[model samples]
Target chain A: MLSVLLASGVANGLLYGLVALGVVVLAKAANAFNFSQGDVMALGGFVSYAVIVTMGYGSVAALPIVVIVALFVGVLSYLLLRPLMDAQHAVALLTATIGLSFLVKGTIRLIWGRQGDYFAVPPLVSGPPIILFDGAVIIPLQHLVMSGGAVLMLALFALFFRFTRLGLFMRSVADNPRAARIVGIPTELVLCSAMVLSLVVSAVAGFLLAPATLIFPDMGFSLFLKGFAAAIIGGMMSLPGAVIGGVLLGVTEVLVSGYISSTAQELSAFVLIFVALIFFPRGLFGGRSSRSV
Target chain B: MKLFSQIVGVMLMTTALAVPAFAQDVQGVSDTSIKIGTFGPITGANYAFGRLTMNGLETLFADVNAAGGVNGRTLELVRVDDQCDPAGAIAAVRKLIFDDQVFAIIGGSCSNGVMAAKEDIEQSGIPFVNFAAASNNISAPEIENIFTSMLTSNLESALQAQYLSDLGVKRVAVVAQHDAWGSDRHKTLLPALAEKGIEVAVDEELSMEANDATAQVLRVQGSGAEAVVLLSYPKPASIFLRDAARLGFTSSFIGTSVIPDPVAFDEQVAVPGATDNFVTISPSRYALDSAEAAEWLEKLTTKFPDDEPHTYNLYGITAGQLTVAALEQAGADLTQASFIAALEATSGLETTFAPGPLNCETHQCLQAAAWIKRTPEGKTEVVGLSTLD
Candidate 1:
């Protein structure tokens, strides 16, 4: 049971963390929650699916093309997000993201029509499900894929921020865009890069999620809400916090639904979020950072 | 005041004439245009159900109209997006029946949304054939004006317990949504379980909007149960299955129709990882080998090319087919009474009807009808099908 739970949690958490990363990138870089982050995730999954199925690209061959497509989509989404960034309350940004979410979901409807697609996909992660504790539960090879991708993404993100000049400039802008601008930083470019990175993360999350959940236009709305909840529980601005929140949330949900009422599942999550807000307003592992710096 | 009086007078005249052709039956809705109306959500959380529902309705209408119309009157459908809200449902019904002057109505995606507006539907006086909304309360005690095209959730849960018992699974954990509908399932299922000498190890409730089911998974896993029964919608159902794996809950999972969406199998049902020991019940099955089913599917898909033919897609098409059969029995130059009588006279008529006692004496869906589906090899295969005896 332990092995299976950890395996599933790691995979589920990693996908969620990727979504949270998108939220973190936007929130940290531009102080906004891309409400459409969920739809973007759904869009990434479907786009790759189309590339593989309709365009006849093998899933392995589709990877590079998917990345390029994801980047282009990220740029387009960034351009869309630009106007909303300047709004005073940030609610404008939220609404715009929501609108984009709706639009993308609607567009998916137009494309897929109304039926559930039953597609056959190959095993991305190799090896058998590792069973532990007298074979009580088993962990599948996909867990490795999920774990490796999550750790790799986080490492890449950290490395990019730690040493690269572009990363440093972006960090300065995120920490204080006005100050960075005063120091001759190109704020627009920084924001654009944030959008690009956010979308890339979102696309990978979508690709990972598609294998188990399959592709549906409406799937994004739920993913968006979950990602949003994870971001909120993780302080809405911290990458590590978002990662922790995603895993914590994924694990909590499993325990709750297994033991308690499924109806009370969301109720309990809200209770946890509410309690966290009251006690540790900055979330677990949070520190105060000021854009005014 | 005079204008209001005039409007009332006009309505009265329209009603009177419309009823018996005394003066109000304005349009000749014949072979070129037989108008029907539907209400569904164009916005909100459950909006996808409505959108897909609309697609099915439109496709079926086109199919019916193409096959030489119903009694020589072409089928025409008018739609109003209700956004799946109660207040919105009421307004959509009013607009369709009162304003659009449709002959009949079939528009339900959510039970709560429809149940809230039942009185408004009763008041409408138009024949209402529901394509969705699976609550017995919708048709209980025989409203006469309204009828459903699917099985109620109560029977659905009982059937789940019965099927599990048949499979020799004794101990089970039931996870359900925490709403009136989900609660209704819990209330119905426990008694059904007890009667069958089966014990519920863990009975849990989760919210429809939840993203994970960790706590719920732990309780079910800790309950020492072999199988887990889920009475949930799609969103939580997906989270539950995925999270169940993450929590090391290796118990077999059996879910309601809400989660057996075939597309999810192709998308994220993560079969080998997420779907081992998982099986679910769909409303009915269309085995590729079942001649009637294959013919029906072919006709339906061809007729309504725009709709994705899911389980519910079949429901709408079946009901439409039943109505068509009833209308045919009504003969040309039919009236409302003749149409009702034709439907009442059905004995063993199996025109897209699932296996159930078609007493026709009671307008209720007698017994439950469903088939079990499993993603054994990345395909949603109907392993077995039966109607409750």
Candidate 2:
């Protein structure tokens, strides 16, 4: 039971981490907390559902379509937030994104309202459960894929932030937006790029998680709240903290559920967030410097 | 002065005689049409229950109207979105009563929402025919003007327990939602199972939005139960089934009227053969694609082009049939009181797709349900019938 709970927790936690990663990136690079990150992820999943289910295309075909749609959505989101971004009003930006969240949710509901309560997206790799301990403990193939996808995405982002010119620009902006602007970094363009990158990450997470979560309009707000809790636990501005926080939350939820009760599992994420905020205000990995690493 | 006093006395007598005659006229009834109001969650997570049922009511009304109208009165439906909430249901019912002035109501989809507005409905003295909301309290206490055609939660719970008991399942696992809908059944189910000499090995709570049920599955597997009773909507149930299959925890799964269509449920689970041992209790005897329901399905498809035929729609059609029967029985000099009387007097009323005759002894009309199973080849078959004795 412990092994099964641990495995399940880690797998779910990684997916939540991917959602947090997108949230932390926007919070860092754009100096803005995007409330709609979860909805954006839901949009990605539904778009992929359309590709894979409605259009009768495979998961491979849905990826490019998701990326293209994410690009358009990210750019549009930047354009909508541009004026407020210039003013640098945190509350205004946050408020606007909440509205964006509603708009996105309403749009998704409108499009897929009559389809069903929940739509299934077949796992990327279709096969049986991976047996361990002579079938005493079994891990689903999709869980493994989901975990690997999260790790791979995390690694790819790490490489990009460390090696790419665009990554440098984003880091500079995160350290000090005004300073980066002074150094001839097109601040608006960089922020736009950050939004795009964040959404793409979130969209990819949606595609990976869709098999487990299923596709539904109401899935957004709950996932958003979970991701937000994860981001806060990890420190809102710290990327690595977000991932760690997500895994911690996921594991805690599973363990609590396995050992304690199912009702406690739902409360575990919020409780953890509360404890993290009270004890480690800057998070476990958060540094004194405002810059996110 | 004497002439003026005499004239005023005559005028007062004339006004007093006319008041009773005008007061007898119903609010939504006219010579040419009978306007009925319906409320459900046209939007939100439970829209399938609400929206599709509303569509069914609409289609049924259209069919009735097309058939030369109901006793020279064309049925007009007035729908309001309840948002599947208690407050929303109250507002919707109030709007129907005070604003729309609908003569009678023919729908109530969300259990909690409808239950919330029960007092208001009872107080308003309007005839309310409940379509899909199955909280036992909605009609079991026997409100004079409220009648439910759907099998009440208590009946379904009793039937589920009986079915499990008959299967010789001594130890059973239960996974139910803790919300109003689930609580209504779960509260009754515990005692029902006990009465059947079935021991509840494990009890778990699942939320409406829950995507995973691994921990619950593991716990259920550990319990060594012979069967599992799912007291949730299709989403959580589907997740539980899929997770159960993934973890190789196989057991006989039993569900209630909420999962009406076995074929749709099998598809929703997405795992091949996951629903092999799954059987659900449905109020409708006929499947959506069954030969008996082909004509009604055609009518539903013709009215709502984008929607595929659903059991929820059939529920609404049943409600409409009940309302029209009561209306026809009420006679042309229709009023709220007469409608209530007609509904109360209606017994052994058979309608399209109903599992049993709707006999409103305690305002809970349908007491029987049919067990539905989906074949591996995607065919929904009715295995058997169970009626509460």
Candidate 3:
């Protein structure tokens, strides 16, 4: 039972980390947290549903389409909010993203509301359960794929951020956009690229998670809240911190519900966020300077 | 001048003779049409209930019109989106009654929403036929001119308890959501269990959008429960079933009308034989794809290209059928009072999906519940029918 809970916790944790990664990436690039991150995730799932289920494409074939749609959404959101970003009213920019969230949600309802709720997507891979510890721990093949896929994506993102030129430019912009702009970093392009990267990460997360759970217009808000909590626990800016915080939060939730009461599962995230904010304001691995103005 | 005055007087007299007089002043009735309004969450999370119910009503109305309508008057639907909130429902009902001036209403998809708007409906004196909201309070006080075709929460809870007791399952646990819908059933179920002198082994709460239920299942298993009553929507219930199966804990899982579609629930669980130990009570006897509902399925799908017929749609169709019956019985002098009287007198009227005779001696029109179980072969079977007090 312990091993099963741990395995499930870690698997769900990785998906939550992916959501946190989207929040962190957007916050870093645009200097504002995109409230529509979850909606983008939902949109990605819906797009994949349309491609794979409605358009009769294979699950693998839907990947490129998801990427294309994510890219389009990212760029469109950037263009739509470019004026607010330029005006430098951070709160207004964030508020505008809220509107964008509602827009996306409403559009999804208009287009796909008739499908009803909980539209299940078939898992990318399916096989027999991988049992261990004398049958005490049972992990489905889909969980393995979801966790492994998220880890691989995170590793690729880490590599891209470390070794790539555009990645370094994004880091510089995050540190000081005006300085980067002065130093010929093409800060706007970096910002747009970050938005695209953020959406791509979130879209992939949605694709991984939607197969296990179901997809609906209302699925985004809960996911977004959890991911936001995860991001906050990770200091809201550190990529690695986001991953660690997400795993910790997920495991804690599972453990709390497992040993404590099931009613506490929803409250566990906020509880962890409160504790993390009080005890480790900079997060466990977050830098002291991670806090933005 | 005298000739012109005489001609005008004669023309006025002839026009007065040409006018027809109605038995009573019906708000929304005309010589050619009768407007019926419906209110539900057409655009929000509960759209599944609202939109589908409306679709069912529309499809039935279309068929009725095609078959020459009720009393030679075509049924026109006036839809209002209440978003499944109480205040929204009241406002929507008010708008439907006043602005739309619908002759009757066939809606109320959310329990709290319907209950909140009950007073407005009762006061308006409009013939209101509820199709989806299941809270007993909506019809419990026996408000005149208001009737519900859906199974009431208290009745379903009591019937579930009775069925479990009849099976001699002594140790029963409950796993229910904490939302309004679940909480209402839970509150009713506890007392019903008390009436049977059976104490619940355990009572646990799960969220509406819960993706995992290992802890919940483990707790219920720890409590030594032989049976589990699931007061949940399909998603959480499926998750619980899957987790229970994964944990190798096989308990008799009983559900209410919330999970009317066993086949859909089985598919959602996605585990082989996860639903083998599952049984549910539904207001309707047939599944959406059942052979019995083929005609309705075809009409619904054909009429509304985007919508598929489900149990909620069945409720809507039944509501429409009952409304039409009463309209026809009202005998072309369709006043609100006459319509209400006709509905109150309705009993044993057969519809396509009703499990037993539709009765409305009281405001609770639907009193029969069908026990549906999913076999190992992935087919749904009706085990029995029980009419609750």
lDDT by residue for model 3 (B1-389), tens: 67864564464334223322432446788988999999998877788789888999899999999999899899999999999999899889878876887888999999889988886677566789999989988887888878999899998998898888888888899999998788889999999998987779988877877766867877898899889999998888877887777667898999888788788878767667778889999888777767988888998889888665677888888889889998999989777778899999998999887777788998788878888987777777888888765
What is the C-alpha lDDT profile of model 3 across A79-168, one tens digit per residue? 988888854588889899899989988988889886666676666676566897878777766668878989998999999899999999
Q: Pick the candidate with the highest TM-score.
A: 2
Worst 10 residues of 1 chain A by lDDT: A114-123
lDDT of 2 by residue, B282-318 (tens): 9989888889889989988988998766889889988
Model 1 agreement with the true structure over B1-389: per-residue lDDT tens digits: 67864574466345524665653332324545657777877555465566666665676677777788877777777888888888888778767766787766777777877887776666545667676777877877677667766667777767877887887888988888868878877788888888777889988776655434555676777889888887876555666776565445687777776654543542454434666666777655553224656655676567656554555566566566656666678777665556667666655556454544343445554345555554545555665655554
How far off is each candidate at the interface, as Cα RMSD in Å? 5.9, 1.8, 2.4
Clashes per candidate (backbone, < 3 Å): 56, 0, 0
lDDT scores in order: 0.68, 0.85, 0.83
**Candidates 1 and 2 compared by lDDT, better number:** 2
Taking chain A of candidate 1, what TM-score results? 0.87
The residue-by-residue lDDT of candidate 2 on A31-50, one tens digit each, is 78777778888988998889
**Which pairs, if any, clash in model 3?**
none
lDDT of 1 by residue, A1-293 (tens): 45555665666777777788788887778887776677778777777677776677766765666568668877887888788777484887778877877777787767764334323334455454666677786766666676776778778888988998878888898788889999998888888888888877877777766644445566677776667677778878777888887877766655454444445555655776788778878876567645773
Which candidate number has the best lDDT?
2
Q: DockQ of each model against the real complex?
A: 0.22, 0.51, 0.35
Residue A209 accuracy (lDDT) in model 3:
79
- Superposed by TM-score, candidate 1 places the C-alpha of residue B120 at a distance from the truth, in angstroms, of 3.5
